[model samples]
Target: MPTIHSGPVCRLFVLLARDAPLGVVFRQGPRQLTQLFLWHTNTDTFEPGDRFVGNLSPERGDLSPDGKLLIYVAANYTMGHHNKGLPPRWTALSKPPYLTPLALWPNDEPYYLGGLFAARGSIEINLAPYALEDWREHKPSFPAGAPPEGLVFEYENLPWTPSNQLFTRLMRSGWSQVPTRQQSETVDIAFVKAHPTKPLSLVLGMGSGNSHTYTVHHEAGNAKTKLVGAVWADWDQRGRLVYSLDGKLFTAELDFPGKLQPSEIADFTTTARRRPPTPESASQW
Candidate 1:
């Protein structure tokens, strides 16, 4: 068995822009929490930037392909130790317990990002929307009464392209409890990394305890077999994917409509011995 390090083990979450050399990393200390840092490919060091004082995990947000926009889930409540206020009566019968408000942050800005509302749940950005305008105008909601037509309730599980053109969802295969109906469950997709250049291809990370990666082709209506087991993953440039498994790093090629394979790039278990911890290492892919 691998001996767990007892010292402060810093956890890092990196988000790299598809078209730009810039990236942002959220570092959580085993003993303390600090601000996020900026990473540039041209520089070997990471510089401190904005401080995130929220309790929400950093994995909840992602950078756009162009590296200009950031879409992330922001909490409706305030941060810190305080009693959670009473829930509205409508929450019991109709409304969701928490509202999912997505904030779109720009790289150029130091503080503000556009705030947009969506259904409360795990959400991700669909890199290829049918039309940019459709994505811009999309307002998702779940009411007690009749919901709007063509609304995507599973936007979190599947990637959205313009016109809902290419997407995937989890469906059940067993019989349903209801008479003459089959029961189905949505595949709890934990993370989605769309191809930066390909509109119809992307990778889906699923599973709760044991992670699995799958290559999806929206237009073909089929996906390849599990490519590998990964706790989390992110896209690099056009055809590369970086993922973490068993506390080690690996890279794979995105051969959509073809076989996908992964190769080990770095092992955190041993790398600690070679170099001291630094801000750049916290954001290293």
Candidate 2:
């Protein structure tokens, strides 16, 4: 068994850009250092980006459909903590693979942070409309040919929290919540999403204090295949299972059920922390 406090475990969480062949990968490791990478899904390549000394829950992050803009929570809450006159946490809109915000909103609380792109110009912050934005720093840059009028999305005032934030994304990705008998205090919630075309489903168990888990289950009452070393997993647009495992990204070929034919995509295990130039896209407007 691994020691609970052995040390900081390096891991990766990825947010695939909507309707684009790109991804924003959050590499968390070395305690206090969370780095970014722009991944090209088509080529299985990565471009290293900037790093920050804070926290980024990737589940609370989103990328624009154009794969040009990113919305995420940059939080570090400590009792009575202060950072050079900065808030403990804030929601930021930035260019992919960078922490420099094109726009910023001070989160009233941790749970109130994070956002998603609803359409070409519409954005939802905290599952709420763009009006909920605090407007601390408001300057959103769009790529060439993007509509400017619909930047603000119309969203319902739904209850938003760190937990439900994740659930919202899961539901959007075709996952349905499954009621679980909570026998322990740590057990929180779980969701399952079946393959769009396959007879298999992916089960996700995210607990209150326990570790998050993912497994592949056969809907034919056959087997529940636990993806070894899987920290996060989901079916990609190609019906392949893409997951970040042991500090690297991989895509599995589901040719044979109950067996994982894992193929490495990118090896992020050795990515060193460094300052990267602002991507050219963020430099405009």
lDDT of each: 0.38, 0.71
Clashes of 1: 3
Per-residue lDDT of 66-160 in model 1, one digit per residue for the tens?
A: 44334443322343322453111111111111122222211111121112123333223432233233554333323323333442223343333
Question: TM-scores of all models?
Answer: 0.37, 0.80
The C-alpha stretches of model 1 lying farther than 4 A from their native spots are 1-11, 29-35, 41-54, 59-186, 189-202, 205-229, 246-249, 253-285
Task: Candidate 1: give its CA RMSD in angstroms.
Answer: 14.4
- The whole-model C-alpha lDDT of candidate 1 against the native structure comes to 0.38
Q: Top model by lDDT, which number?
A: 2
Alpha carbon deviation, residue 164, candidate 1 (Å): 14
The local lDDT score (0 to 100) that residue 157 gets in candidate 1 is 31
lDDT string for model 2 (1-285, tens) is 111223335788888765778888888887877888888887877888888777877778777877888888887676545645556777777877877666666654555678776645877776333433534343233333343455674335644777767777778667898875622244467788888898998888777664777878886756677775577788766677898777777887664457667788876767555655775766443
Regions more than 4 Å wrong, model 2: 1-9, 76-86, 127-147, 153-159, 181-188, 255-257, 273-276
